[model samples]
Target: MSAAPVIVIGSGLAGLMTALTLAPMPVVLVTAGRLGQAGSSPLAQGGVAAAIGVDDDTSLHLADTLAAGDGLCDAASAREIVGRGRDAIMALESHGVRFDRKPDGSYALGLEAAHSRHRIVHVDGDATGAGIVKALVAKVRETASITILEDCRALRLIKRDDRVVGVCLEGKGPVAARAVVLATGGAGGLYEATTTPLGNLGQGAALAGRVGARLADMEFVQFHPTALAVSAPRLPLISEAVRGEGAILINDRGERFMADQPGQELAPRDVVARAIAAEIDAGRKVYLDARAALGEGFVRRFPGIFALCQEHGIDPARMPIPVRPATHYHMGGIAADCDGRTNVPGLWAVGEAACTGLHGANRLASNSLLEAAVMGLNAGRAIASEMTAATVRLEPVSLPQMSDPAPVRAIVSRGLGILRHETGLRAAICALLPKAGHDDAAAVALAMAVAAFARCESRGSHARTDYPHKNASGTRKLFTMDEAFAFARELAASQPLSRTA
Candidate 1:
């Protein structure tokens, strides 16, 4: 007659992995849409990064991750997550994930940008995410201990005496439990141009922030360089693997501009994104030209991207694919340790919702999937060890009503997109603070603006036009709602005139 022992508020790789790891234990898994349709997991085209190649090891993977993080990565956490990469891959394989294999019966390792070794483990070529998610969904469906709450959405976390006791759903009402795991993904959906699922509005982080949870690295959002520029709500991603396979970036003048950069098209994501942004800002069109590189094999190798291009009326084999920088991933979230334990007792966060310091400023290509699987397993085991027989207490909880997401998306796109300036950031906060009055989406946007403004210098994904140089201090930022509001108020009070007004 007791409620489920644990409740996971996501359906992505992290949520499913956590549910599977805690086998034989009753857990309720909630999703806003059908299991795999509303998250970034199924949209992942680059596959997962693991040092499973004969020529590679964890040390080299650690080095690549640290370098891409741009000095903000927690070295210990990075080492821990990357160290578990092979084991995570093996575990996924055991769960029925069929990774692409070579003729010799070995894994077909891939090369992605910022990685020195060919270590990406994929499935069906570019449909890696779909393959992995399909396998997990099938396995989870077979598990009797796990209850699926299809179309049920979590509005907020219910806390009592500084401990999270339950989550309030939008329609079904409150479901209390001994433990609440927030596996909700990133805030990229807050922006107009983004590659994340539309449901990913940072609800989990907003819920945590409302209850005074610590958030870290909220300023660092990685902008992927090759999001297809089209008039659509969901931006299709031209995978980084395309570049790794020898694609070149060209400007409107038919020039290979990336040739001047050291890494060419295979540079770190931040560099490539900025370069593409620069070209776009200079009134020159930027395109991902794989015509001479991948050629006809593009359709066979990357059927997902090829289909997306064809649907948009472009062919990668014949013409250049239009590309631009768009909000891709967030390297920041609720400040949690490697085990997904947040400061709030009885509450844990995993996946992109939890900032475990594995990704510093920018995430390396294909590492998000790896981090999700590895960290989800660790958190599941940790939560399993701390389970108790405490009775579930369901209670009536009032939730905040969020305003239309249009205004927040516009402000974020202008100020927090790829390039930022001091004046624009301050203006963005002033506009956003008033709208954040009980709106969870606006509050998440405010948190990001506050953190972005607080960090005076540019680092990795957080680029500033005014303070164009990196600060000498390599300190990480941690913030709360009060701190962010305080900074926003102070900033508004200092400015005599408001550009947003």
Candidate 2:
């Protein structure tokens, strides 16, 4: 196995940005598919949120992000991310990302949920992710310092004592580095309906847990309230930017009803999406009626959405698009500082795998891309600052064997799935832990269960009805693999599963 100073798992914006920021350092990037194929960034339809517009600034942007986060955001991290928004935008542009511009040479910035200003910067209409990924991939290819290993999956972290030493890539075998960055994205594939990439099965968070890294807010799973109910597991996300451009949220009876609701479709994603889910559960079809709102501008402004709609046999220029809530961003992961250093000595995290607390309860739309770019760069420099050729050498590690996946899927989907109540959460803890027999799936299931148990109070995205009260402190509960497993095992023995949960 080829060893390097830095090993980054996943090639999304976070991983790419981290590698690029490192400049001349030798790094190995292992991705589950072709560099960008398994990441959701390329499928992102909205633009990145930055405080770059004329009327917008970091303060206003920070306020919007905090409000949308629903009190879970760390103020310092929020300020750090928002304050650097302009730089992140510039970095993307400098990397040759061609953003959509107005006729006068200004950015054709659009608006999104929770922002009071038009601060979203897009490219090629609605293909913001595609454009950004194109530029990032090109940069990664051009960089002689970075080694891109595709069709590789990181199965588990190799932990020697309290710190992670390296990762075991499933087929590639053990490739060790002094420092490992968990940029493997979110845990949406853990659920039945999700908008994350299929490979975003929550392994990074679980990997972090096995080595005793502090995990933050694991229960706060952001459910993107508007995933198009496609005939797939990781359902296609219907971009929220469409609603920002004058699309209206309507029920089956052709009623425009979101304005009367708290937060509206333009509200925090959880509120808007849950509202939509309520309508759907009540035997009504929830749809985004952009046909009348955006009219012909729909095609000109949202080409990606339009194309996707066409592929799905829906005419967005004329007909309303069907949508439902799907699992999106995960707010919990290996807790990191501003520089992406986790609690472990040689381990770091960036992008969706790092919980910087910038996005608390819910992530503001498009802030994800901006976070990846900003933190990826910062983590790279941070890694370089802490390491040397004398630090450690690469060790050959082997991937752990996995159990049958069918029961694993059933456990997460049915019990730990969306809308968890007390009975289901506890029962799920009981059902999944004993079967955890030394595998990646077991570790992940244990971590998920531990998070479900500790968070007795429902706050932010983690809605638990049994422990329905929201704690005022709502302090982030960090857990180790043993702590989480032990707690889950205990809870499993005590509480019985509820039918509704």
Candidate 3:
């Protein structure tokens, strides 16, 4: 028997990288929307983090990553992934990602929060994601072995005994494959205010969890502190690169509020997000004042963001941009090892969909791109190597009936957003679990809430209002779908339910 073609779900940096990496071998890349239109990857303004600077090294990158993770980052995986940053950048460059370079013929490395060195490799100033994805999409187009399924959403994984045989798409029915790679981005779309693309509703996590794939770190959702406070559906991210270049956060009173914190504006994302949340809770509007700092150069440096500001009629060259904390990244997903292999055979997870312990509690700025590239490459190779002669069966698996996203988004925003409490989290679990039923997004949401409920003390992005401090124990909670539902029902049964929830 010959090996079957691999089916890869999602079309972000991870999915593209994985498919491209598995070159020469046949691959079917599926996305919910047209190529390059949606997914959180193209919207990533911050460039890929890598230690390519002459003064930088992988050890320093590892230290910064570990610190940002808040003690839950898998140390071995962190070191391994961070160590390959330079190689990952080079690989991306080969695939048409033209990173910005200085006039002196060196990589124009940009600085980001919590990074010890100026090691962010960007393109077109602030439109790094757009540049990289455009190039990779072009490369994928040129490749004859890769078949792209545009406007097709993956519904569920077709299982035969233990190993995943293929994926069932929405418009297109079930497609058989020897291996499956889930690169479905994060679950940020589960929240009301988020920086992610609208379609990124944790579909990947939900699909994987439906088939008993282990999920880890479901509680840590990184909130970016500087999403443009607009009334629009999708929130525009004011890249951390702006803050890296001396932009200061201000309140309605023209006060430089970050002055009290140790690192001020340069603190880890969790710290900055919490600070912004605190300011908002205190009845003060927050703003990112780039007027004095970047001045005229703001447009030239961050043309994408500047254009965004202009699109909304707020000139960054003059006034400060109104900003607030928005759901950005989920540091949890289908638990996969370094090679992107899930607990179930023939099923692999890469990019944001896979919790490889790279991001831990909170992901450092730009590390998401780096992880996506490195892990996608590794997973591609791993899957390619696993294409053996063993015959796999593709059974007709029933797809999950998902509910309206509005209610699920509302539940996540109220129960699992910036601040969480025991009562509210339990209430949220009860509401979300029943609504979720067998839906992947709801399943992932319930998992996140259950993980949040399990962790009593605040740590990293999983902050709890009741247990207001970090606990002595540093633990990463892993859960199966059954385990999560059982725990949620048990927990909800023990507590009195809230009428509003």
Candidate 4:
């Protein structure tokens, strides 16, 4: 029989790039929904951050990334990833992705929060992610070596002797493979208000954690400060690029609440999000006033965002956008190395699903795309070099129950939201522990609650009401599924269940 193919779960930028990079090596790309239509990648409004401009360099990009990471980033990993920004951009271009360019034929660059330089490479203005995904999807469709499996979900990893041998797909049974790559996106969907696709419930971390893979930095969830405040399943994102173009944050009473801050509206996302949260908490509404800065030019610069605003009966050219904080990104995930290798052999993870220490406490805007592309390419090369034609027999495994984030959403949103504390974290753990054994979403939420409970100090996106100050020295937290469950059980046993409305 022919050797089983390398299986890639999820169809976001990272998974697509990995499958493409492993050309002629045979790959089966599995996704829960239609390819390129499910994950947060296509919903991304921000562009990729790269030091490709003559005035910019990797040093400046590295500095911005580390500064945003807030001292938890692995210095060596940050340096290496930022240094390869240009290369990642080039590789994306090679795959038929074209970034926006200037009249003089130079790549047009834009600035975002916490970025020290104009290093964001966008496409179709604010439709950067859509543009990139469209191009790559076409490229992937034409690749003969890749077998696309859409509308399929990976239920669990089939492991033997600490090595992942295949995957158990829902309704499809087991498919043997030499290796498995999980690019399953993030867990922002666990929140009541989120900018990510509602289906992204940290499935990658759940799948990995169940198989004994180490998960890290699970408490750090980055909330975007400018999601269009509307009643919807998934909130519409007001790109940071809007602020990069000089918009300001204001309260309903016409007060520029962020004016006193050092960076004003361009501060790190954590700072801006907290400031906005404070306003909302005080019974005030927040807004992003773009009239003076962009005005009519807003349509020309951010056509996508302009249209989205129009859909909600707001015109960026004339009025301010009603904005509020919403869960947007997760900086913590399955702990993976630079090559996307998980602690479990033959298992790999990339994109937001893998915490490679490139994003420590928080991720700098636009760096996500760069990291996904870079790590995808690196992992592809590593996997390709280690490819073996030899096949292994896999033991039959029962399929896991389908995950439903609905049950755990309220608990996670209450405990692990913009601000966290011991009481809420413990309450969430007690609520989630029972469901976690059978529900993947609850398992992931329980892990996050455990991590949040363990972190005693506020740092980056993780703000604690009880511990408002950051520790002089901070270290990343790593835990396995067993460790997280044990911790949660211990905490539950010691403390009475606190009531959460």
Q: Pick the candidate with the highest TM-score.
A: 4
Clashing pairs in 4: none
Global lDDT of each model?
A: 0.89, 0.80, 0.89, 0.92
The clash count for each model shown is: 0, 3, 0, 0
lDDT of 1 by residue, 104-142 (tens): 999988899999999999999998889999999999999
TM-score of predicted structure 3: 0.98
TM-score of each prediction? 0.98, 0.94, 0.98, 0.98
Once fitted onto the true fold, the runs of candidate 4 whose alpha carbons sit more than 4 angstroms away are 387-389, 498-501
Highest lDDT, which number?
4
lDDT of 4 at 375: 89
lDDT of 3 by residue, 111-163 (tens): 99999999999999999999999999999999999999998888888888777
Stretches off by above 4 angstroms in model 2 are 1-3, 161-163, 389-398, 404-406, 467-469, 495-501
| Each candidate: RMSD | 1.3, 2.4, 1.3, 1.2
- lDDT per residue as tens, model 4, 1-501: 778899999999999999999998999999999998989999888799999889898898999999999999988888988899989999999999999999999998999999988999999999988988888899999999999999999988988777898998877888898789999999998988999999899999999999999999999999999999988899999999899999999999999999999899999999999999999999999999999999999999999999999999999999999999999999999999988999999999999999999999999999899989998999999999994845777666865676567768988988899999888888889999999998888998999999998889999999999999999998999999899999988877887684543
Candidate 2 residue lDDT tens string, 232-340: 7568777888888788888989887787976577888877866787788789998898877888888888777788788889888888899988878888888999899
Residue pairs in clash, model 3: none
When sorted by lDDT, best at the front, the candidate numbers are 4, 1, 3, 2
